[model samples]
Every structure is written in C-alpha cells, then in structure tokens.
Target: MDGGGDPQVAGPVIAALMERAAGETRVAMSPETAKKLIGLGATVRVESGAGVTASIPDSEYEAAGAVVGDLASTVAGADWIFGVAAPDVALLSGAKPGAKVAAVFDPFRDRARTDAYAAAGYEALAMELMPRITRAQSMDVLSSQSNLAGYKAVLAAANTYGRAFPMMMTAAGTVQAARCFVMGVGVAGLQAIATARRLGAQVSATDVRSATKEQIKSLGAKPIFVEKVAGIEGEGSGGYATEMSDEYKAAQAELVSSHIAKQDIVITTALIPGRPAPRLISDAQIATMKPGSVIYDLAVAAGGNVEGSEPDVIVEKHGVKIIGFSNTPAHLAADASALFARNLFNFVSAFWDKEKGEIVLDEEIGTAIRLTQDGKVVHERLLG
Candidate 1:
C-alpha cells in the first residue's frame, strides 16, 4: 500500500513480498508484471530487496511504477498479497480483513498453513491447484517452472558426469554420444528430452501415458515404453500421470532396468500431485548403470523417483553420481522469476473487471484454486 494513504488512489492494493523459504530465489512479481498490474488501475507495492535473489533490484520496480518499501509498509492495508510461496500467516496480519493471497500454498503437504489463513480471515488461492484447461494455459505456473527445472536437471547431470554429452571425432579416435534417458514425459520430461537432444546426447524417454510417445519422437528422441500393458494409459486429471497398477509397474521396471543400464545420463521427472513421487530406479538398478554415469532426480523434493537421491546432494553409488535440487528452478532464478510473475499476472488480468476495478474470478478457476474463504478451509479437497 502507498504510504501517503492517498484517497486519490483507485482499485485494490497488490503487494509482492519477499519469500521466506530457504533457497527460494524466485520472486512472485517481476518488474514486467508490476508494470502490467499498474496499467490495470491497481496500486502495486513491492517490498524493497524482495527480488534481490532473483537479480532484480528495487530501482527496477520503482522504474516500473511500483512503490518499493519495507515489509511492514508494503503490506499495510494491502488488499491482495502475492508471493512465490505462501508468505507466513504472521506476515499477513497487516492486510485488510478477508484479503486475497494468491500463491503456492502446497495445501496438501502443509494444511496447517491453510488453516492459519482461514483463521485469519484471508482468502487463500493455491496456484498449484489451477485447473489444467486450454483457457488457463498461460497461467500454469507448474508447467512454466517445471519446463525450466527439466532443462536444468539434464545440464546438472551432464556437468557431474565424467564424460561429455556430445561425441567427438578427432585425429585420435571417434567418441560415441552419451546416452540419456528421460522418465515421465510431462512438460518437464519433454523439456528434458529436448535439452538432452540439443546437447548431442542419444536421448530416449518413457512415460506411463502412451500418448507422449509421439511427443518424444518429435523432439528427436526414442520412446521406451512398456507396450501392450494394461494401465499404461496413466494420464490423470490435470494432465499429470497417475500411479500405475502393480503389473504395469513391474513391466516398467523391467523395461527401465535394461534401458537405464545403457544410459550414461538419466533424468527422472515423474510426480503425482499430492502424493510421494513414484520410485523409478532401485539401488540395484543404480549399480547396473556404468561407472561414471550420472542421474538427476527432478522430483527429489517430492520424495524422489530414484533411490539414493538426496536434495541438493550428490550421492554416489557404484561410481554413479546421483544428484538433485529441492528447488531446481531456483538455480535459474532470473528466468524463473520472470515466467512465474507473468503467470500470476495472466491469472489476475484475465479476471480483472475494469468498471469494478477488481479481480472477479469465475467459478471454473476460482473453485479449482481457492483453498480458503470466509474464515474457513473451503476447498473440497482439504475439507474433512
């Protein structure tokens, strides 16, 4: 909120606060989005130094017509609070009653936070719950962030591996291309395949959803699938892959065991919403991989898809290096922040009512993402 308390100011106050989570480098609002929000007749405030980790300075926000101030001044009387992760409930104490907070609440994993928000009379919008529909494509933060995380996963694995991704032919001898395998061809997996292929690796990918086979081939990668298996069509609601049957899991494990043994680099991106990541590689499977091989688990933060993968640690097994980051997109913070801010801006502007000078979310998106309203946990998924 503007410090002057200017009565001339119109529309709701939108504020972007600093992220409190450890290793969170991305900011929810960027200068680009701040400018767009201001154009929509809203007052935009950003906490000074909030974007420092993402390499965005306070001067940039000021130049974009956003008022920059400390945390207390930024949130004071604000109507809407924006954040990458949901800000601590304590931080929202200064906001107006029933203020709208739009961010990644991770409601299933952290119900206590949503409960606090409900008790505080704040409207909690969990961006991760944004429905997967054609109209909401531009507002999909998961896809935006996961795409970058997938590209980073492959690059990190390539860096850790002793061998080069591309083959070399010199006066000495011709070197073969490194073999890369991507598990779970979601947005992240597809990006992993594309990135690995760009790095000159012989890329192959697999997914429970057979529909992704063509997507893999389009990226010039081979598709390794457990064909003719029941439950192989595992695409779930919101385009996420669901848990497969025991029979399908066995077949997948068998196929992956043989394929992974030959892979020089493996990147796993499988994840089920509100559930632990499905295990893809076992300790025995890791041992089968060649010495000096590298594996990057993109789902380590969600309990991991590869055995022995630890967040932000390089675990070596049988001379194979397994690595992953709890917050993969934060490694490329600048771009990640830009895309994320745009996604939030897209969601808000799509529902902005010009005459009313406020955002009025329609039932489709509102019901899908709203976790709390009217001082209660209103989301059906979270209600007991």
Candidate 2:
C-alpha cells in the first residue's frame, strides 16, 4: 500500500481522481468504489482502460456514475489521488499545492520514493501502515490484500503439484491426503491454512506467537512453532512479529528444517516490516524435501524465507520445486482490486465530511497514515 493523505480541506474538493498506474494491473478505484465516492459528494474520474487488466470494462465505471477520461484530463484539479501503488511523483507534482495522494506506497522499505512524493507537494497515506486499532479496521489494506495472497499461494502450490490435495479411494488402496505446512500466522497465513483445509489437505501451521495455536487448531490443523519459541513469545507489537534472538532463530531453523522434509506443500509468509523476510527454509533443508514436493514462498518479493526461491521464477532443486511469484494478490486481480479499492474508499470516507463535501483528517487515524504534509515529513517513524 502507498501514499500520505492531506486530510485537511475546508473548501470545495475537486474530483477524486483514479489515474492508471503504468504496468499496474490493479486499479485503485473500482466501479463499486466510484458509486460510493459519488455518494460522498466527490466527482469521480477514472482514467480510461484503468481497470481493463482487472477485466472491468469502461461501461462499468460509467454505470457507477464516474466519468472516464485520459489520465491528464481526469487528474486535472484532483483534490484526492487514490492509487494501488505510488503514482509517478512528477505527474502528481503538477496537481494543486494542497492536493492529497493516498496509496499503498511502502514508506518504510523505500523511503526515498515516499520522500519524492512529499517534495512534489502531496500528502502520502501508506495504507499498510494504518494502525491496527478498532476504528480503522475497515481501512486496513494490508489484511485485505494479504488475505487474498494467502489464498492464492495455496492454489498456486496445489496447481503446481502433480498429486492431489485430498485423499483418494481406489481399488488399489487409499491415497493419503497431501500434507501442507504454513509458516507465519498473520492474515495471509490464516487464509492459507483455511484454503488448504478446504481443499481437504492435512494442514499444519507455525507462528512465533502463542496466540496462533488456538486459531490453527480451530481450523482442524496442527500448530507448529509452539515449543521452539516459548521464551520468545509475544515478541512483537501491533500483532506483528519482531526479530528473534540469534539463538532462537537457530532453534527455529533446526525445528523448521526437519518439518520441511515431510511436507507436500510448504508456504512461507513470514515478513518483518522494513526488513528482509526471516529465513525459514535453507538450501540444505530444501535438498531434503521429496523430489516432487512444492514450496511456495510468499515472502520471495521481500527476499524469500525459503532458500533459492527467486522472485517470479520457479526452480526445482534435487526434485523439489520452489516457487516465488511476486504480487500473488495481483494474480487474482479482479477481487484484489475490488477489496483494495474499497479500502481506499473507506480510508477516504473515514475523514470525509458528507455535509461539507470536504476532508477532515485531524483524527488520531491521520497521525498513523499521513507521511508528509505542506512539503514536510509528518509521520514520526519516517522522521526518525
């Protein structure tokens, strides 16, 4: 997720513009969102062909009360710039001085790009960094997008595997159900467990938090990492896992390596914010997996947790297959775009004054999302 929203507005707001992000298949504003924004008293303009990759036709936007135009024409007088990722900084710099830009712009991993948006005079709202508070749940983009990613990761792994997920009965004998192991228990991991179980696979999961054990068990799957991380339980904040001690990591590696050998499908979803993904599977362990086993590394884009998992590349090592595809959610673009677009709508609606047709962003939620304003960095973590 990207952007910093300049939530303060007193006068009439211009159109809530959705420009086509080059090479991005996910559109920030879907037809569903256009209708919602229209009801909020904001004229919505979606760039022509913006949602085509998501298989949404232009007629859909028109039907939702949004005008379709070329990027420049749509962006003119843009008060709110909503996007899936960061838009071209130069393109947004041409907007009005107080214009606001909101998107899933990763402010922490790539601070320079975010800073460029600030220098160009747009407030950025990194939707992923929205605090995990009760009120902001509807606007939580990371969970929405990641939930899709986890579901897709399993489907991808299952499709790649030559065998079936569920047990089969035959005149010969009863075939055993595929064994699936999921690493990490965030929104993505939980979805992975549910998806695999729905496919009738024997699912087992691991997480650094003890809290995940019940969730894992409730899904009728076994919980891993319960014994190994005892002393380091609750080592994170905001429901995210923090860095473990070197010794604890070593123990985890030993435990996870042994577990990897037996799994028919392995999905690694471990990611520490602003850091390389924690390495859970090593090359030596990969070598030990059965020749036909498939490992799907969701963390591959963040420097994979599984060794030899290349970004967007598939490789087989000693008979085992390693898959590392970037943007798994984008692979399921239609729903990903819909969910993401809704998140953007909810984020804007949270601050929009329906009566005044203006944005009021001074709430505490603003403090977590607004990265820069008035040509200055506003988020405390970004400043440090």
Candidate 3:
C-alpha cells in the first residue's frame, strides 16, 4: 500500500481522506473539491465510498482526477491528510510517521486525545482553531459549518412549534407571528436572526458585545441588552467574544429573565472557545417562559446555555421544549460536506505551490491551528 513517498519531499501531495467512525455522516472532500485540489498540482487520493453517505460516488471522485482506493492505499505514504473529523489512531495505522492532519478535532474538549495524536507522531491542524481574520476567512471551517447550524436551528424551532412563524390572515381570525429571541450575536446567532426574520417571525437578539447591536439591527432585529454590566464587555480578539465575569453574568441574567418569559422561541449560541459554555438561560427563567415555547440551545454540547439541555436530545421541561441538536452541520450532511470541502481546498491551495511542487506553512493562521510539531504539542494555548 506504500505510495513510495518521502515526508519532506512529498509534502505537496495531500490525501483528502475519510473516516470509518460510526454515525459520522460528513466527508471532508467532494468530487468538485477534489478537482479544485488537483488543479493545485497535487496528487489527491480519496478513499472509495468515502463520500457515499454524502451522496457522492467513487466514479465522481475518479472523474475529478482523484485516486480511489481503500483506506490503506488512499493514505499510503500521504504526507498530508484532510478529513471532516480527526481519524482514530487505529485508522492511521497505515499513515506515514509524521503525516499532517487537518480537521475539526475538538482539541479543547478532548485534551487527552489531542495529546495522544502528538505522542503518535502526528502534526495536527485543528480546523476549529482557524483564526477569525481576513486572510483566513476563505478557510474558516467553523464559520462555514456554524452558518448552517444557525439557519437550521430556526427551522427546527419552526417545525416543532405548533404555531406558525409568520402572521396568518385566516378567514376565522388573524394569527400573530411567533416571537424569537436569539442570545449570542456571533455567526450562528446572526444567521438565526436572518432565518427567523425570513420566516416572518418577530425577532430580537442579545449579545454581550455592544458592537454586535448594529449588526443585529442591520438584520431588522432588535438588540436587547443590559446597558451596564460589571464584567462582560462583549469584546475580544480574533473577532470572537471573551468570557464574562460572575458579576456581569448575574446582572445579565436578571435583565434577560423578564424578556425571555414573553418569547415563543429562544435560541442561545453563546460560547467561549476552550471554556465551558456559559449558562445564559436559568431554570427559573425557563419555567416562566410561555407554555409550548421552544428553546434550542446551540451550545449544549459544550455544557449548555439552558438549564436542562442534553446533547443531541429533545426533552420537555416546565411545559417548554428544549432541543439540543449536537453537530448541527452534520444534520445537513451533503451540503455541509460540500461547503466544508471547499473551505478545506481553499486552505490547502493557499500554501501549495503548483510549479515548485512545494508546501509552505507560512500562514499565520496555520500556526494558531497547529497543535503538534516535531512530535511535541506546540501551540502556546494547548501547552497550558
């Protein structure tokens, strides 16, 4: 199965492969994505049937100039490996000694697994750490995936709610639009606002960062906030919010409780990278919410914003429904895979040299996501 490759010499050719992890429905690369990667003058190998769950066939991959093979042959001597999720160490048994892997590895959540990847002599680029910067925008997997989640969250709420999102003029009587309140004005929250608005819902949003108020308003949604909070400034580096202090949390909760009680749907997207998701919705606030209200907590996997949310489950509490759909992007696997693959292709083509057939890891964003190098955990944040 060896493809006769030398690590230093073959760094230019990358294998956008797949994993056999059960229930993982997304593939890192599609047929069209393979074609784009090949245009960069790199030999691309796609494992046969890798994209099957995504509705892409082996013939399509081959037509796009990719070598179709089993996992062993596909990863054979490949210096670089790209995937939707990090492959299990067992899956990498046939990989080269120092193969570089780029994927959504959830580094902070699985510190031990990340350490194992480093100990196994693999250099990892955790796509979740892709910095929010102009240069890295085209390659930001988190935004691409989270954009899907935000839109879908609204749809999930709309579908589950007994009432309609838009006002209906029935012959019997006029029905008012559903009220939606989204907390967290990041990519997901903004998308949720846009989707809910499009569905004709009366949407309002809140964020710790006052800067996001303009953005929320731009989307025709009201920005709700506690004007004065002791600790939460809603400002941070790399275009994401930092953690809020206890004092700010207490004050914000008091302000939000009253507003939440009147809403029909509440979608919480507040999250701080490398930290447990903040509790934005309390048990008491949830109990007071209108009966039949829907609460979709996007951060449930990272602890949760709602009091009783569980990862990937839908449960009712206090006459209200809490929908916690884990890996939201994966629910829309085909389209999600397509967008994710395109982002992966952009990231690789950025550093790949066509004529010279060389790989350059000079992108500043690359350093941020690089979790291991030369058989050691290298990223400064991960070191802690």
Candidate 4:
C-alpha cells in the first residue's frame, strides 16, 4: 500500500473519500487469490462492488480478509495493482509512486500507454513478456491464455463449417471426415489441431518451426510442410513464432494454396509480437477454396492471417467464409480469469519480499523482470 500519508486520514473530507471508495466494492479477485494476497501481508482494498460482474459478492472478499475502501483510497496507496487488461494512465497516475503494477500490458498494441506508465515511475510488469524458459513456465500468462484462445478458435471455426468434423456413416453411405489445415503450430495452433482431431477432422498443421512437426504428429495430426524457402527460422524466445522472410512466405502460400482448395476448415494462429500479423492467406488463395469452407484467424486483432478478415466479423468471399475474432479468450472469461490469476500469483511469488514489504529483485529474477522494467524496454534481441 502507498507508504506515505496517514492510513487514518486527518478529517471528514479524506474519510469521506475513503468511505466512498471502500467496503465490498466489486473486483475480479477470487476468494482464493484474495487470501493469497493477505497471507503475503498485503491488504486488499476494494470498491464496494468490483467483483459482482465476475459473480463474487462484496461479502465474499470481506470473508476472505479484505478491507473494502473507496476507489481513490483503495488504489492510492496500493503496493501492487493486478488486472487483466492494461490499466489506463489515469489509474497508474493515481497509484502511489513506486507501486508495482502487473497486467497483460499489450505493449504491442498499446505502446503509448506503457510509455506513460514508465513516465509515471511505476514498475510495470508485462506478463505477456514472460520468458518461455523452463524456469518461467509457471509465470507464462501468454501461453495459458493463448491455449484457451487456440481451443476456442477451433470451436468457433467448427460452428461455422457446414460439415461435421468427425467422420460419420449412415445407411446411404459413409461421410468422409472434414479436412482441417492449421497454420502456425504455436500453443494455440497445436491446441486447435488437437481439438479439431478430437472432433474427427483430418488435421494438418504448418509452422516455420520444425520442432512443431513432431508435436503435431503426437496429437494424431499430419504435419504439412509448406515448401521451405530461404530465411525461415524456427521458434524465437518464449516459443513464439518469429518473423519469416517474404520469399519464404510466398513459397508457403503456394504450397498452402494447393492444399487449402481441398480443406473444409483452416485455422491460422501465427503472430509476431508488436508487429502486424503476417499475412498467410491471400485473397486469391481464399478464392480457390471451395464454397462453405471456413477459415478462422486467431490473430485477427493483429490484422489477421487471411485477406479481407475483419476482427469480430465473418465475411464471405468467393464462397469461402472467413471468421476473424478479437479477444478470443474473452469467450471463456471465468476459466481465463482463473488461469490468469494463477500466472500472476506465480510471478508475484518470485519477487515479493515479506520482511521488507517490497519486492527484492534477485539477479535471475531481476533479469527476467528487466524484460520490461522501469519504463525501459529490454529484451535480448532488442539489446542486440
């Protein structure tokens, strides 16, 4: 909590502000998470109704040892602020100086906001920047959330396709299984393949990373290698897909186009952080696809993998239906919130200092946190 100023404000004016902001104001925090914070010697100051939208009542937080406060007081002296979305500059400005803030911090999409947080002198941790190393696995919010996004992407695509995923048979004849082509075999892409196969689709997935081929096969899906052109590197730090060269992309397109014509559904999940999503499917390529086929772009918010895709809008061109979705994981809010909270907990555990009531950054953890620390962006590649 903000270390300065009297906890009991001097008079009615400050007390009134605290009263207005305090007591059972709803928050997204669950009881289990609230207890964890209290155990760490942090008090949970919530508005009277913060968690209502998430279905937990004010009484629930109080039962978990939280002291309800008005909005201004709750956030004013907060030692740390936790949220799913990147908080606005106004909220960060209100926080006591040097307070730690943790969130997804979509730096790629909201660089300006992050820059402002840096200017405000608050330590902002971007969970999305967690390293993809073995030691950092527990703290990886991106993979956890993207895993759900991948699962939901397939479900969304399945709903739009005319044919069923699995093979079926009737007295008349045997219905062949739907063919699914998945691009970018990252966490989400791999999940999409598994989900599609579970639904009985004959699934094939592609990625610049050769390592993903074995993973795809292990899930009982075929590994479709788009012709490898020059400059195709595999995976980057954190198991994220790195950018590919234009020549490599053209070759991939040629190979994918040939296979896509026969596919019943296509799910694309390739994304490069801070960059516009690589365009994998051209309008011409989509044109060759049969009518009633479905294409779901998981990177729709990053400008999409398919041509003519509009975020949250399903468009049809040349008989092929392209579905683009923004905020794919928002579809499973409760589950996503839980996983996200766990990631935050694990990350906070690494830095919290109980004795001093502040985070003590160890060498290793300091390096990790420095990936986006003190308002200066620092990554291995960026430093290079």
Give me the displacement of residue 337 in model 3, in angstroms: 0.8
lDDT of candidate 4 over 37-107, digit per residue (tens): 66776666666665665566779778987666666766766667776665665754456665666666676
* Candidate that would win on TM-score: 1
Most accurate candidate by lDDT: 1
> Under the 3 Å rule for N, CA and C atoms, how many clashes does model 4 have?
20
lDDT of each: 0.92, 0.82, 0.85, 0.73
Root-mean-square deviation of each candidate, in angstroms?
1.5, 3.8, 2.4, 5.2
Two-way lDDT contest, 1 vs 3, winner:
1
Deviation in angstroms for 170 in model 4? 2.6
The regions of model 2 sitting more than 4 angstroms off are: 1-23, 226-235
| TM agreement with the true structure for every prediction | 0.98, 0.93, 0.95, 0.86
lDDT of 4 at 344: 70
TM-score of 4: 0.86
lDDT of 3 by residue, 1-384 (tens): 223364333324577666566667899998898887777666788888888888888999999988898888787777788889888766776677888898988888888768888889998889889888788899999899889999999999888888999999999999999999999989999999999999999999998887888899999999998877643444576778887777877888887988999999999998888889988888899999988999999999899989989987888989999997877887888999999998988888788765567566775876889998778999898876
Off by over 4 Å in 4: 1-28, 227-234, 363-384
As for candidate 1, its clashing pairs are: none
Backbone N/Cα/C clashes per model: 0, 13, 0, 20
Scored by lDDT, model 3 comes in at 0.85
The better candidate by TM-score, 1 or 2, is 1
